[model samples]
Target: MKAVNEQEIRASFANCSKGEAKRLALPRDLAEQPWDDLDFLGWRDPGAPDRGYLVTERGGEVVGVALRLSARQRGHLHRGMCSLCLTTHPGSGVSLMTARRAGQAGRDSNSVGVYVCTDLACPLYVRGKKLPDLGGRLEETLTVEEQIDRTRAKLSAFLDKVLA
Candidate 1:
Protein backbone atom coordinates (compact mmCIF):
# COMPACT_ATOMS: atom_id res chain seq x y z
CA MET A 1 0.00 0.00 0.00
CA LYS A 2 1.10 3.56 -0.60
CA ALA A 3 1.48 6.13 2.19
CA VAL A 4 -2.14 7.17 2.05
CA ASN A 5 -3.35 10.32 3.79
CA GLU A 6 -6.75 10.69 5.41
CA GLN A 7 -8.31 12.13 2.29
CA GLU A 8 -6.89 9.43 0.08
CA ILE A 9 -8.21 6.85 2.51
CA ARG A 10 -11.65 8.41 2.70
CA ALA A 11 -11.96 8.43 -1.04
CA SER A 12 -11.70 4.67 -1.07
CA PHE A 13 -14.98 4.30 0.77
CA ALA A 14 -17.60 5.06 -1.82
CA ASN A 15 -20.78 3.96 -0.07
CA CYS A 16 -20.11 4.01 3.65
CA SER A 17 -21.21 6.82 5.95
CA LYS A 18 -18.72 9.44 7.01
CA GLY A 19 -18.92 8.45 10.66
CA GLU A 20 -18.22 4.83 9.92
CA ALA A 21 -15.47 5.63 7.46
CA LYS A 22 -13.80 7.90 9.99
CA ARG A 23 -13.44 4.98 12.38
CA LEU A 24 -11.56 2.72 9.96
CA ALA A 25 -8.11 1.51 10.93
CA LEU A 26 -5.28 2.07 8.52
CA PRO A 27 -2.13 0.01 8.13
CA ARG A 28 0.71 1.14 10.38
CA ASP A 29 3.35 0.84 7.70
CA LEU A 30 1.51 1.85 4.56
CA ALA A 31 4.71 2.82 2.77
CA GLU A 32 6.20 -0.62 3.15
CA GLN A 33 3.17 -2.59 1.94
CA PRO A 34 3.77 -4.75 -1.12
CA TRP A 35 1.30 -2.90 -3.32
CA ASP A 36 2.65 -4.45 -6.48
CA ASP A 37 1.53 -7.90 -5.29
CA LEU A 38 -1.91 -7.07 -4.03
CA ASP A 39 -5.21 -7.32 -5.86
CA PHE A 40 -6.65 -5.33 -2.95
CA LEU A 41 -5.82 -4.57 0.66
CA GLY A 42 -7.32 -6.67 3.46
CA TRP A 43 -6.35 -7.11 7.11
CA ARG A 44 -7.31 -8.49 10.48
CA ASP A 45 -7.24 -6.02 13.36
CA PRO A 46 -4.79 -6.78 16.12
CA GLY A 47 -6.73 -4.81 18.71
CA ALA A 48 -10.07 -6.37 17.87
CA PRO A 49 -9.16 -9.70 16.39
CA ASP A 50 -12.64 -10.25 15.02
CA ARG A 51 -12.61 -6.98 13.15
CA GLY A 52 -11.17 -6.63 9.67
CA TYR A 53 -11.06 -4.32 6.67
CA LEU A 54 -10.88 -4.56 2.88
CA VAL A 55 -10.04 -2.07 0.17
CA THR A 56 -10.12 -2.75 -3.56
CA GLU A 57 -9.73 -0.83 -6.78
CA ARG A 58 -12.46 -1.40 -9.37
CA GLY A 59 -13.12 0.62 -12.50
CA GLY A 60 -10.19 2.86 -11.59
CA GLU A 61 -11.72 3.84 -8.25
CA VAL A 62 -11.08 2.66 -4.74
CA VAL A 63 -13.74 0.83 -2.73
CA GLY A 64 -13.11 0.16 0.93
CA VAL A 65 -14.94 -1.48 3.81
CA ALA A 66 -14.62 -2.04 7.52
CA LEU A 67 -15.31 -5.76 8.08
CA ARG A 68 -15.14 -8.31 10.86
CA LEU A 69 -13.74 -11.83 11.14
CA SER A 70 -16.27 -13.96 12.86
CA ALA A 71 -16.05 -17.40 14.46
CA ARG A 72 -13.13 -19.50 13.41
CA GLN A 73 -13.05 -23.06 12.15
CA ARG A 74 -10.10 -25.15 13.17
CA GLY A 75 -8.00 -27.16 10.71
CA HIS A 76 -9.94 -25.91 7.76
CA LEU A 77 -7.24 -25.49 5.18
CA HIS A 78 -7.61 -23.12 2.22
CA ARG A 79 -7.94 -24.62 -1.24
CA GLY A 80 -6.84 -21.25 -2.62
CA MET A 81 -9.96 -20.43 -4.64
CA CYS A 82 -10.43 -16.84 -3.51
CA SER A 83 -14.10 -15.98 -3.03
CA LEU A 84 -13.02 -12.41 -3.61
CA CYS A 85 -10.75 -12.96 -6.58
CA LEU A 86 -12.42 -15.98 -8.19
CA THR A 87 -8.93 -17.24 -8.94
CA THR A 88 -8.07 -20.87 -8.20
CA HIS A 89 -4.83 -22.19 -6.74
CA PRO A 90 -1.44 -22.38 -8.35
CA GLY A 91 0.22 -24.60 -5.70
CA SER A 92 0.92 -21.41 -3.78
CA GLY A 93 -0.11 -21.21 -0.15
CA VAL A 94 -3.48 -19.58 0.27
CA SER A 95 -6.44 -19.90 2.68
CA LEU A 96 -10.17 -19.52 3.13
CA MET A 97 -10.97 -16.68 5.54
CA THR A 98 -14.16 -15.28 7.00
CA ALA A 99 -15.14 -11.86 8.34
CA ARG A 100 -17.85 -10.61 10.66
CA ARG A 101 -20.52 -8.13 9.76
CA ALA A 102 -19.22 -4.55 9.98
CA GLY A 103 -22.35 -2.53 10.75
CA GLN A 104 -24.38 -5.49 11.81
CA ALA A 105 -26.34 -4.27 14.80
CA GLY A 106 -28.71 -7.21 14.72
CA ARG A 107 -30.29 -9.91 12.56
CA ASP A 108 -28.66 -13.40 12.64
CA SER A 109 -25.62 -13.30 10.39
CA ASN A 110 -22.67 -14.23 12.57
CA SER A 111 -20.12 -14.17 9.78
CA VAL A 112 -19.34 -13.83 6.12
CA GLY A 113 -17.03 -16.03 4.03
CA VAL A 114 -13.92 -14.90 2.20
CA TYR A 115 -11.03 -16.78 0.69
CA VAL A 116 -7.79 -15.01 1.45
CA CYS A 117 -4.30 -16.08 0.56
CA THR A 118 -2.38 -17.55 3.46
CA ASP A 119 0.11 -14.77 2.83
CA LEU A 120 -2.52 -12.02 3.07
CA ALA A 121 -1.50 -10.66 -0.29
CA CYS A 122 -3.82 -9.31 -2.99
CA PRO A 123 -1.11 -8.04 -5.32
CA LEU A 124 -0.41 -11.55 -6.47
CA TYR A 125 -4.01 -11.94 -7.55
CA VAL A 126 -4.07 -8.47 -9.10
CA ARG A 127 -0.97 -9.23 -11.09
CA GLY A 128 -2.58 -12.56 -11.98
CA LYS A 129 -0.87 -15.41 -10.20
CA LYS A 130 -0.29 -18.52 -12.27
CA LEU A 131 -2.94 -21.09 -11.39
CA PRO A 132 -2.65 -24.87 -11.55
CA ASP A 133 -4.97 -26.00 -14.28
CA LEU A 134 -8.44 -25.09 -13.06
CA GLY A 135 -9.70 -27.10 -16.02
CA GLY A 136 -13.30 -25.95 -16.55
CA ARG A 137 -13.87 -25.55 -12.84
CA LEU A 138 -14.59 -21.80 -12.93
CA GLU A 139 -17.51 -22.30 -15.35
CA GLU A 140 -17.26 -19.32 -17.68
CA THR A 141 -15.48 -17.66 -20.56
CA LEU A 142 -15.15 -14.23 -18.96
CA THR A 143 -11.72 -12.68 -18.62
CA VAL A 144 -9.86 -12.20 -15.34
CA GLU A 145 -10.96 -8.57 -15.10
CA GLU A 146 -14.59 -9.62 -15.37
CA GLN A 147 -14.17 -12.16 -12.61
CA ILE A 148 -12.64 -9.54 -10.34
CA ASP A 149 -15.43 -7.13 -11.13
CA ARG A 150 -18.09 -9.67 -10.21
CA THR A 151 -16.38 -10.49 -6.95
CA ARG A 152 -16.08 -6.84 -6.02
CA ALA A 153 -19.70 -6.15 -6.81
CA LYS A 154 -20.73 -9.07 -4.64
CA LEU A 155 -18.68 -7.67 -1.78
CA SER A 156 -20.19 -4.21 -2.16
CA ALA A 157 -23.67 -5.65 -2.09
CA PHE A 158 -22.88 -7.65 1.02
CA LEU A 159 -21.71 -4.50 2.78
CA ASP A 160 -24.86 -2.67 1.83
CA LYS A 161 -26.94 -5.42 3.35
CA VAL A 162 -24.92 -5.29 6.55
CA LEU A 163 -25.36 -1.55 6.89
CA ALA A 164 -28.99 -1.50 5.89
Candidate 2:
Protein backbone atom coordinates (compact mmCIF):
# COMPACT_ATOMS: atom_id res chain seq x y z
CA MET A 1 0.00 0.00 0.00
CA LYS A 2 1.08 3.58 -0.60
CA ALA A 3 0.38 6.82 1.19
CA VAL A 4 -2.59 8.62 -0.36
CA ASN A 5 -3.81 12.18 -0.12
CA GLU A 6 -7.36 13.31 0.54
CA GLN A 7 -8.04 14.19 -3.07
CA GLU A 8 -6.79 10.82 -4.22
CA ILE A 9 -8.91 9.04 -1.68
CA ARG A 10 -12.00 11.04 -2.61
CA ALA A 11 -11.52 10.32 -6.29
CA SER A 12 -10.99 6.63 -5.71
CA PHE A 13 -14.56 5.81 -4.89
CA ALA A 14 -16.32 3.58 -7.44
CA ASN A 15 -19.70 2.83 -5.92
CA CYS A 16 -20.95 6.31 -5.11
CA SER A 17 -21.39 9.68 -6.76
CA LYS A 18 -18.43 12.04 -6.76
CA GLY A 19 -20.33 14.48 -4.58
CA GLU A 20 -21.06 11.80 -2.02
CA ALA A 21 -17.46 10.69 -2.02
CA LYS A 22 -16.36 14.26 -1.47
CA ARG A 23 -18.60 14.50 1.57
CA LEU A 24 -17.70 11.15 3.07
CA ALA A 25 -15.56 11.28 6.21
CA LEU A 26 -11.90 10.31 6.02
CA PRO A 27 -9.82 9.13 8.93
CA ARG A 28 -8.54 11.98 11.06
CA ASP A 29 -5.24 10.24 11.55
CA LEU A 30 -4.52 9.68 7.89
CA ALA A 31 -1.10 11.25 8.16
CA GLU A 32 -0.12 8.83 10.90
CA GLN A 33 -1.43 5.69 9.26
CA PRO A 34 1.08 2.89 8.69
CA TRP A 35 0.59 2.86 4.94
CA ASP A 36 3.27 0.27 4.27
CA ASP A 37 1.42 -2.22 6.44
CA LEU A 38 -1.99 -1.70 4.96
CA ASP A 39 -3.74 -3.75 2.30
CA PHE A 40 -6.55 -1.18 2.35
CA LEU A 41 -7.60 1.87 4.28
CA GLY A 42 -10.83 1.39 6.20
CA TRP A 43 -12.65 3.29 8.91
CA ARG A 44 -16.04 3.97 10.39
CA ASP A 45 -17.22 7.57 10.25
CA PRO A 46 -16.65 9.15 13.65
CA GLY A 47 -19.89 11.09 13.54
CA ALA A 48 -21.91 8.29 12.00
CA PRO A 49 -21.11 4.86 13.33
CA ASP A 50 -23.19 3.12 10.72
CA ARG A 51 -21.16 4.50 7.86
CA GLY A 52 -17.89 2.84 6.89
CA TYR A 53 -15.36 3.31 4.10
CA LEU A 54 -12.82 1.08 2.37
CA VAL A 55 -10.17 1.87 -0.20
CA THR A 56 -7.62 -0.41 -1.81
CA GLU A 57 -5.24 -0.42 -4.72
CA ARG A 58 -6.18 -2.57 -7.68
CA GLY A 59 -4.25 -2.82 -10.93
CA GLY A 60 -2.20 0.20 -9.85
CA GLU A 61 -5.29 2.36 -9.27
CA VAL A 62 -7.10 3.02 -6.05
CA VAL A 63 -10.66 1.74 -5.77
CA GLY A 64 -12.93 2.62 -2.88
CA VAL A 65 -16.35 1.57 -1.62
CA ALA A 66 -18.73 2.92 0.98
CA LEU A 67 -20.19 0.40 3.39
CA ARG A 68 -23.04 0.31 5.85
CA LEU A 69 -22.92 -1.55 9.14
CA SER A 70 -25.96 -3.30 10.52
CA ALA A 71 -27.56 -1.50 13.44
CA ARG A 72 -27.97 -4.54 15.65
CA GLN A 73 -25.11 -6.75 16.79
CA ARG A 74 -25.80 -10.45 16.44
CA GLY A 75 -24.63 -13.59 18.24
CA HIS A 76 -22.28 -11.88 20.64
CA LEU A 77 -21.31 -15.12 22.31
CA HIS A 78 -20.68 -17.13 19.20
CA ARG A 79 -17.35 -17.37 17.43
CA GLY A 80 -17.40 -15.54 14.09
CA MET A 81 -14.76 -15.30 11.41
CA CYS A 82 -13.96 -12.34 9.22
CA SER A 83 -14.27 -13.23 5.55
CA LEU A 84 -11.33 -11.00 4.69
CA CYS A 85 -8.61 -12.12 7.17
CA LEU A 86 -10.05 -15.37 8.51
CA THR A 87 -9.63 -14.04 12.05
CA THR A 88 -12.07 -15.38 14.60
CA HIS A 89 -13.82 -13.01 16.92
CA PRO A 90 -16.54 -13.00 19.48
CA GLY A 91 -19.61 -12.24 17.37
CA SER A 92 -19.63 -8.69 18.71
CA GLY A 93 -16.26 -8.03 17.10
CA VAL A 94 -17.66 -8.89 13.69
CA SER A 95 -20.41 -7.08 11.81
CA LEU A 96 -22.28 -7.48 8.60
CA MET A 97 -20.99 -4.86 6.18
CA THR A 98 -22.83 -4.15 2.96
CA ALA A 99 -21.61 -2.14 0.01
CA ARG A 100 -23.95 -0.93 -2.70
CA ARG A 101 -23.12 -2.39 -6.07
CA ALA A 102 -21.52 -0.09 -8.57
CA GLY A 103 -23.42 1.85 -11.26
CA GLN A 104 -27.01 1.01 -12.14
CA ALA A 105 -27.23 -1.96 -9.85
CA GLY A 106 -26.56 0.39 -6.94
CA ARG A 107 -29.35 2.67 -8.10
CA ASP A 108 -31.55 -0.43 -8.10
CA SER A 109 -30.67 -0.99 -4.40
CA ASN A 110 -28.47 -4.04 -4.99
CA SER A 111 -25.69 -4.61 -2.51
CA VAL A 112 -23.14 -7.24 -1.42
CA GLY A 113 -22.66 -8.09 2.23
CA VAL A 114 -20.04 -10.01 4.20
CA TYR A 115 -19.05 -10.51 7.81
CA VAL A 116 -16.01 -8.42 8.59
CA CYS A 117 -14.22 -7.12 11.63
CA THR A 118 -16.39 -4.39 13.14
CA ASP A 119 -13.44 -2.02 13.27
CA LEU A 120 -12.43 -2.88 9.70
CA ALA A 121 -8.78 -3.26 10.73
CA CYS A 122 -8.05 -6.69 9.39
CA PRO A 123 -4.65 -5.78 8.03
CA LEU A 124 -3.33 -4.71 11.40
CA TYR A 125 -4.91 -7.65 13.15
CA VAL A 126 -3.42 -10.16 10.78
CA ARG A 127 0.06 -8.68 11.21
CA GLY A 128 -0.24 -8.78 15.02
CA LYS A 129 -0.03 -5.02 15.14
CA LYS A 130 -3.38 -4.66 16.85
CA LEU A 131 -4.97 -7.31 19.03
CA PRO A 132 -8.54 -7.53 20.25
CA ASP A 133 -8.95 -8.87 23.76
CA LEU A 134 -12.12 -10.88 23.32
CA GLY A 135 -11.40 -13.51 20.71
CA GLY A 136 -7.99 -15.16 20.48
CA ARG A 137 -6.17 -14.85 17.20
CA LEU A 138 -6.08 -17.94 15.03
CA GLU A 139 -2.88 -19.98 14.89
CA GLU A 140 -1.70 -20.04 11.30
CA THR A 141 0.05 -22.76 9.34
CA LEU A 142 0.95 -20.30 6.58
CA THR A 143 3.55 -17.55 6.64
CA VAL A 144 2.57 -13.90 7.24
CA GLU A 145 3.01 -13.14 3.56
CA GLU A 146 0.80 -16.06 2.65
CA GLN A 147 -1.87 -14.89 5.09
CA ILE A 148 -1.72 -11.41 3.65
CA ASP A 149 -2.09 -12.78 0.16
CA ARG A 150 -5.10 -14.79 1.20
CA THR A 151 -6.72 -11.77 2.78
CA ARG A 152 -6.14 -9.64 -0.28
CA ALA A 153 -7.56 -12.28 -2.59
CA LYS A 154 -10.70 -12.67 -0.53
CA LEU A 155 -11.24 -8.94 -0.27
CA SER A 156 -10.64 -8.47 -3.99
CA ALA A 157 -13.22 -11.14 -4.70
CA PHE A 158 -15.73 -9.33 -2.51
CA LEU A 159 -14.98 -6.04 -4.24
CA ASP A 160 -15.49 -7.74 -7.60
CA LYS A 161 -18.91 -8.90 -6.49
CA VAL A 162 -19.85 -5.37 -5.52
CA LEU A 163 -18.68 -4.03 -8.86
CA ALA A 164 -20.28 -6.83 -10.87
Candidate 3:
Protein backbone atom coordinates (compact mmCIF):
# COMPACT_ATOMS: atom_id res chain seq x y z
CA MET A 1 0.00 0.00 0.00
CA LYS A 2 1.08 3.58 -0.59
CA ALA A 3 1.53 6.20 2.09
CA VAL A 4 -1.47 8.55 2.29
CA ASN A 5 -1.97 11.97 3.83
CA GLU A 6 -4.76 13.12 6.10
CA GLN A 7 -6.61 14.99 3.39
CA GLU A 8 -6.53 11.99 1.08
CA ILE A 9 -7.76 9.73 3.80
CA ARG A 10 -10.59 12.05 4.74
CA ALA A 11 -11.70 12.46 1.11
CA SER A 12 -11.62 8.71 0.47
CA PHE A 13 -14.51 7.93 2.77
CA ALA A 14 -17.49 6.50 0.89
CA ASN A 15 -19.87 5.60 3.70
CA CYS A 16 -19.98 8.81 5.71
CA SER A 17 -20.94 12.43 5.22
CA LYS A 18 -18.29 15.06 4.47
CA GLY A 19 -18.67 16.53 7.92
CA GLU A 20 -18.23 13.19 9.59
CA ALA A 21 -15.18 12.42 7.49
CA LYS A 22 -13.69 15.72 8.36
CA ARG A 23 -14.19 15.08 12.04
CA LEU A 24 -12.88 11.52 11.97
CA ALA A 25 -9.39 11.22 13.46
CA LEU A 26 -6.43 10.16 11.37
CA PRO A 27 -3.81 7.93 12.91
CA ARG A 28 -1.20 10.03 14.70
CA ASP A 29 1.56 7.61 13.74
CA LEU A 30 1.17 7.79 9.98
CA ALA A 31 4.83 8.62 9.54
CA GLU A 32 5.78 5.41 11.32
CA GLN A 33 3.26 2.96 9.80
CA PRO A 34 4.59 -0.11 8.02
CA TRP A 35 3.33 0.99 4.64
CA ASP A 36 4.88 -1.78 2.55
CA ASP A 37 3.23 -4.40 4.73
CA LEU A 38 -0.26 -2.98 4.70
CA ASP A 39 -3.13 -4.00 2.46
CA PHE A 40 -5.25 -1.27 4.00
CA LEU A 41 -5.01 1.34 6.72
CA GLY A 42 -7.24 0.52 9.70
CA TRP A 43 -7.40 1.90 13.19
CA ARG A 44 -9.76 2.41 16.09
CA ASP A 45 -10.28 5.99 17.17
CA PRO A 46 -8.24 6.73 20.28
CA GLY A 47 -10.79 9.27 21.50
CA ALA A 48 -13.62 6.82 20.70
CA PRO A 49 -12.69 3.19 21.02
CA ASP A 50 -16.03 2.06 19.60
CA ARG A 51 -15.31 3.90 16.37
CA GLY A 52 -13.04 2.36 13.72
CA TYR A 53 -11.98 3.29 10.21
CA LEU A 54 -10.47 1.55 7.17
CA VAL A 55 -9.07 2.90 3.94
CA THR A 56 -7.65 1.11 0.92
CA GLU A 57 -7.01 1.36 -2.76
CA ARG A 58 -9.78 -0.40 -4.64
CA GLY A 59 -10.58 -0.56 -8.34
CA GLY A 60 -8.09 2.23 -9.02
CA GLU A 61 -9.51 4.55 -6.42
CA VAL A 62 -8.97 5.21 -2.74
CA VAL A 63 -12.01 4.18 -0.71
CA GLY A 64 -12.77 4.21 2.99
CA VAL A 65 -15.50 3.09 5.38
CA ALA A 66 -16.48 3.91 8.94
CA LEU A 67 -16.85 1.07 11.40
CA ARG A 68 -18.26 0.66 14.89
CA LEU A 69 -17.64 -2.16 17.34
CA SER A 70 -20.78 -3.97 18.48
CA ALA A 71 -19.97 -4.01 22.16
CA ARG A 72 -23.14 -6.01 22.89
CA GLN A 73 -21.71 -9.04 21.08
CA ARG A 74 -19.31 -11.00 23.19
CA GLY A 75 -16.34 -12.85 21.77
CA HIS A 76 -16.16 -16.61 21.97
CA LEU A 77 -14.15 -18.04 24.82
CA HIS A 78 -12.55 -20.92 22.94
CA ARG A 79 -11.79 -19.83 19.40
CA GLY A 80 -12.82 -17.36 16.74
CA MET A 81 -11.68 -16.46 13.24
CA CYS A 82 -11.36 -13.11 11.59
CA SER A 83 -13.50 -13.05 8.47
CA LEU A 84 -10.94 -10.91 6.68
CA CYS A 85 -7.60 -12.69 7.28
CA LEU A 86 -8.95 -16.02 8.49
CA THR A 87 -6.71 -15.79 11.54
CA THR A 88 -7.89 -17.62 14.64
CA HIS A 89 -8.11 -15.80 17.93
CA PRO A 90 -9.03 -16.76 21.45
CA GLY A 91 -11.32 -14.91 23.81
CA SER A 92 -11.76 -11.22 23.01
CA GLY A 93 -9.32 -10.98 20.10
CA VAL A 94 -12.18 -10.95 17.64
CA SER A 95 -15.17 -8.62 17.63
CA LEU A 96 -18.15 -7.73 15.51
CA MET A 97 -17.32 -4.60 13.55
CA THR A 98 -20.25 -2.85 11.90
CA ALA A 99 -20.17 -0.41 9.03
CA ARG A 100 -22.92 1.95 8.09
CA ARG A 101 -24.10 1.52 4.50
CA ALA A 102 -23.16 4.17 2.01
CA GLY A 103 -25.38 6.99 0.79
CA GLN A 104 -29.03 7.31 1.81
CA ALA A 105 -29.31 3.88 3.39
CA GLY A 106 -26.54 4.78 5.85
CA ARG A 107 -28.29 8.00 6.70
CA ASP A 108 -31.33 5.86 7.46
CA SER A 109 -29.25 3.85 9.96
CA ASN A 110 -28.72 0.70 7.86
CA SER A 111 -25.41 -1.11 8.47
CA VAL A 112 -23.51 -4.37 8.01
CA GLY A 113 -21.43 -6.29 10.52
CA VAL A 114 -18.78 -9.02 10.55
CA TYR A 115 -16.34 -10.68 12.91
CA VAL A 116 -12.87 -9.17 12.55
CA CYS A 117 -9.66 -8.86 14.52
CA THR A 118 -10.30 -6.54 17.44
CA ASP A 119 -7.38 -4.30 16.52
CA LEU A 120 -7.89 -4.55 12.75
CA ALA A 121 -4.46 -6.10 12.30
CA CYS A 122 -5.36 -8.73 9.72
CA PRO A 123 -2.52 -7.82 7.39
CA LEU A 124 0.10 -8.29 10.06
CA TYR A 125 -1.49 -11.47 11.32
CA VAL A 126 -1.62 -13.02 7.87
CA ARG A 127 2.02 -12.12 7.26
CA GLY A 128 3.11 -13.57 10.58
CA LYS A 129 4.47 -10.17 11.54
CA LYS A 130 2.65 -10.34 14.83
CA LEU A 131 1.63 -13.47 16.69
CA PRO A 132 -0.72 -13.81 19.61
CA ASP A 133 -0.13 -16.28 22.42
CA LEU A 134 -3.48 -18.03 21.83
CA GLY A 135 -1.87 -20.57 19.40
CA GLY A 136 -5.28 -21.28 17.87
CA ARG A 137 -4.61 -20.31 14.26
CA LEU A 138 -4.49 -23.63 12.49
CA GLU A 139 -1.72 -24.42 10.07
CA GLU A 140 -2.83 -23.78 6.51
CA THR A 141 -1.83 -25.30 3.17
CA LEU A 142 -2.28 -22.00 1.41
CA THR A 143 0.87 -20.00 0.68
CA VAL A 144 1.50 -16.55 2.13
CA GLU A 145 0.69 -14.80 -1.17
CA GLU A 146 -2.58 -16.70 -1.44
CA GLN A 147 -3.52 -15.70 2.09
CA ILE A 148 -2.84 -12.05 1.32
CA ASP A 149 -4.96 -12.18 -1.80
CA ARG A 150 -7.77 -13.84 0.09
CA THR A 151 -7.67 -11.20 2.79
CA ARG A 152 -7.82 -8.38 0.25
CA ALA A 153 -10.73 -10.02 -1.53
CA LYS A 154 -12.71 -10.47 1.66
CA LEU A 155 -12.24 -6.83 2.61
CA SER A 156 -13.19 -5.67 -0.87
CA ALA A 157 -16.32 -7.76 -0.71
CA PHE A 158 -17.22 -6.18 2.60
CA LEU A 159 -16.70 -2.73 1.12
CA ASP A 160 -18.90 -3.72 -1.79
CA LYS A 161 -21.67 -4.53 0.65
CA VAL A 162 -21.28 -1.15 2.30
CA LEU A 163 -21.40 0.65 -1.04
CA ALA A 164 -24.40 -1.34 -2.18
Which candidate comes out best when scored by lDDT?
A: 2
Q: Write the per-residue lDDT of candidate 3 for residues 72-154, one digit (tens) a residue.
A: 65546667789999887887778889999999999899999989998888888889898855744558999999989999999
Ranking by lDDT: 2, 3, 1
Badly placed stretches (over 4 Å) of model 2 are none
Q: Which stretches of candidate 1 lie over 4 Å from their true place?
A: 1-4, 76-81, 85-112, 125-164
Q: Tell me the tens digit of each residue's lDDT in model 2 across 18-93.
A: 9999899899999999999999999999989998999999999999999999898877678788989987788678
My TM-score estimates for the predictions, one after another, are 0.53, 0.96, 0.94
Residue 67 lDDT (model 2): 98
**Model 2 steric clash total:** 0
lDDT of 1 by residue, 1-164 (tens): 33345566766664356776787667777776676555567766676755666776555566676554435433333345655555555443335454444454432445555654444444445445633343112666877667656755766665565445
lDDT-better candidate, 1 vs 2? 2
Which 10 successive residues of model 1 have the least lDDT summed?
128-137
2 or 3: which has the higher TM-score?
Answer: 2
Q: Go through the candidates in order and give the clash count of each.
A: 10, 0, 0
Q: What's the distance in Å from true for residue 22, model 3?
A: 1.2
